[model samples]
Target: MDEVQVVVAHSERATLRVGDVFLKVDADQARIDIEVEAMALAPVPTPEVLWRKPPVLAIAAVPGTTLGRLGGPSTGSPAAWAAAGAAIRKLHDAPLPRLSGRAGRDVDALAVELDAECEVLVASGLLPAELVTRNRQVAEAALRPWAPAFTHGDLQIAHVFVDGDEVTGVIDWSEAGRGDALYDLATFTLGHEEHLDDVLAGYGSDADVDPEVIHAWWSLRSLLAVRWLTEHGFDPFLPGCEVDVLRSRM
Candidate 1:
């Protein structure tokens, strides 16, 4: 029997890889429902659903490696990054899902949540107060209204798969929902800002994009994710990582 490889193990969910199959064990049924439905509605490439039982979703692994890893540099070529951007553009252009359970983030709630999270970081002494303050101010630009599109709420580079210059698939649809189109673009290039031009070029001339807002989301996401990553036993303080992302805002 092939050994089961733990891809990621967190309290809310876990992913295991055994041979060519990836098993997702999620305690939250609502999130699972959203993932399955979102994958079905998505027009781009995604992992093949093998079967589903309550709390466990099995999918055939897609070929190729992730576009990049968090807390690390990306080896993906400019063309591959652009391919990812094109895929996101296609996803944003697709018709919105009719399902009522589309997940999203509200700016007003985000403000309150950011305040509370910053307090936690400050009180815990996990980060310098000035670092948190500057990022918060930088993040405010993304708090404005945006026309919702079918967005992969957590469109990290690691979620995108690529073979050479072609994007083979995108995984983790749990956070997929109606949200800002630029949020996806911003999320993909969070740690890899140099690739933003290639991505935008691939995304083409359909919609206007705000560079400031993209940068804002970068600061906001890094600030908000630092604590979550640490709690989950992941390091956000690695060199040129989430912490650096916040500091770069200063």
Candidate 2:
């Protein structure tokens, strides 16, 4: 029998891997429902659903290694990164899902939340006030209206898989739905600024690609993530992580 490997575990959810099968255990049934639904609706490759029993959903692992992980060096070549970008473009061009996703939140509401979080970060001394203030200013550029696209709300680098220069699949669709296209682009390239051009090269020219907005998202995501990450026992201050990404903007 294959040993169970803990993929990730936190208060909200846990994922376990046994051989080729992965079991996702989430307390929120709605999130599970969304993950299942989003995977079904997505045009891109996704993990095969093996089974589901209430809080635990099982899936077959996709082929290939992840493109990379945040705070670490990427083993994937530039072509692989571009292929991942092409796959993302395909996903963005797909039809919108029925449900609203995390990335699809109202801009005004998100701005309000961001402002509140910024205030907390400063008052709590979680981040330097100057850093917070500068990032907040940069973040304002992303608060404007945007055309919705089928987005992978949390397109972290680790979620994308590639075999050589071919993108095999994308995973973790719980946050998938209609949202800003650049948001997904920004999320994928976050903390890996060196590959932004390679990704954009394959993302194509027709899509509205704005460097300023992408930079704003880098700062905004880092600022908003600091508190939650710290509380969740994640060290965002590590070299080449969220804090470094924020600092790059200064």
Candidate 3:
């Protein structure tokens, strides 16, 4: 198999084709299919580098022009954001369920996982016990009614691609999981209030997701990321996005 040539590789397990029908490992194994296709939201091109928009599987191409991912996590422009917002509205119309974590492990539970994560951070001396407590509160608050859809586990500007008012692609699906849709939505929308509102408004009156739940999830999302960063030896600086979220919500 010849190596799959591209400017970037989304998964660590990504390999290049060396000969006819040969698979080589430059890194770890890729569990990409289950990870990204579990909850699809949009159409994806074949030989896809981005699967965050699953349900529209993109299989290997016959080879000709570039067929990998096009959007990026950091480079999506405002029009791209707008395009993404439109797509999100359409996706949210799906009949997804609410999370019941700490409640049970049935694909929608997030409470126990969040609690355990924060506790581990505290026990490891990475985060203050107070912060852990704050994280828990935020988590609890975020656990509310919001419709499910094909979600991007860690949806953000970095995962979106836009060209004018069109959404080119949705990248990254490693963290993809089932739960309230806003769990992903808030990560990208809340940070930019106006855009966030635009996204919400785009959903119109038909969407089942609750506004407060989205905000709560935004708070919880920040705490979760902060806790992870702290556990990984990052500083908990004041005025930081994480801190601001926790302080305001918790």
Candidate 4:
């Protein structure tokens, strides 16, 4: 393996190499005969697989730093945000092989889980039926074609690999699917409302994404989710329960 010494120490997950195929971890989903696809990297915290070209692609992980994010979004100028958005535009339209399939997601399992949660909420009268309805509407709108273009299913910032001021590449190809590119773009721009124009300008595509649907899912996650969690007495410190459970489609 070619050693690219870019850090002082390496984490268990960090391995230095140049163009060598990484061996999948034993029992890891990456090990199975499944493909990984490109998706818009969102702001959520999840393990992602980022790629870099040459020169600066090499990395040496600092020991004990693996548990957190690498270099994250810039709090500086909107220009940096603009750069990220532009990079995402390039990534969305790029063509490659389909990397994943929705085999593991169990429809019955999700129904059971959601039903139980809804029941508990109803039992306590903490459930806002309107919020649930809103959430459903949001999900439904985001569930389909926003326009004819490539889409990154799980568009978030964490999947974006930022080097210096530029997003070199994006990681995590798990939820990539063929659908409206706007859905993914909307997800990317939701939290960063201020730079919405920069994001739109970056998305140099003729296709259009449903703004209402984007607004709907945005509402579902930002409003209904908070309301539900507060009513259910769910603590952010608690284990097993993740915000992703509520916004799984994102």
**Best by the TM-score measure:** 2
Estimate, for each residue in 176-233, the C-alpha lDDT of model 4 and write its tens digit: 5455555566556555445567666555545354466665555433433444546455
lDDT of 4: 0.44
lDDT of 4 at 161: 49
Q: Residue by residue across 1-250, what tens digits does model 3's lDDT show?
A: 3555532233343433333221323332233554334334344321343222222323322222111121212334444555566666555444442322211123335666676777776787755678668656656757654444555566765455444555555554545445456666677664554466556554455655566767777766765676655555544444535665566554
lDDT head-to-head 1 vs 2, winner:
2
TM match of model 3 to true structure: 0.60
Of the candidates numbered 1 and 4, which has the greater lDDT value?
1
Which of 3 and 4 is ahead in TM-score? 3
Report the poorest 10 consecutive residues by lDDT, candidate 1. Answer: 96-105
Q: What is residue 246's positional error in candidate 4, in angstroms?
A: 10
TM-scores for all candidates: the values are 0.96, 0.97, 0.60, 0.52
For candidate 3, which ten residues in a row score worst on lDDT?
64-73
Q: Rate the local accuracy (lDDT) of all candidates.
A: 0.89, 0.90, 0.51, 0.44
lDDT of 2 by residue, 1-250 (tens): 9999999888999999999999999999889989999999888899999999989999999999987789998778889888988999999998877863344679999899999999999999988999899999999999999889988899999999988899888999898877888888899999898999999989997878999999888888888899999998789999989988888888
Maximum-lDDT candidate: 2
Return the candidate ranking by TM-score, descending: 2, 1, 3, 4
Which RMSD does model 4 reach against the true structure? 9.5
Candidate 3 off by > 4 Å: 1-30, 35-41, 44-80, 94-109, 144-147, 175-178, 230-241
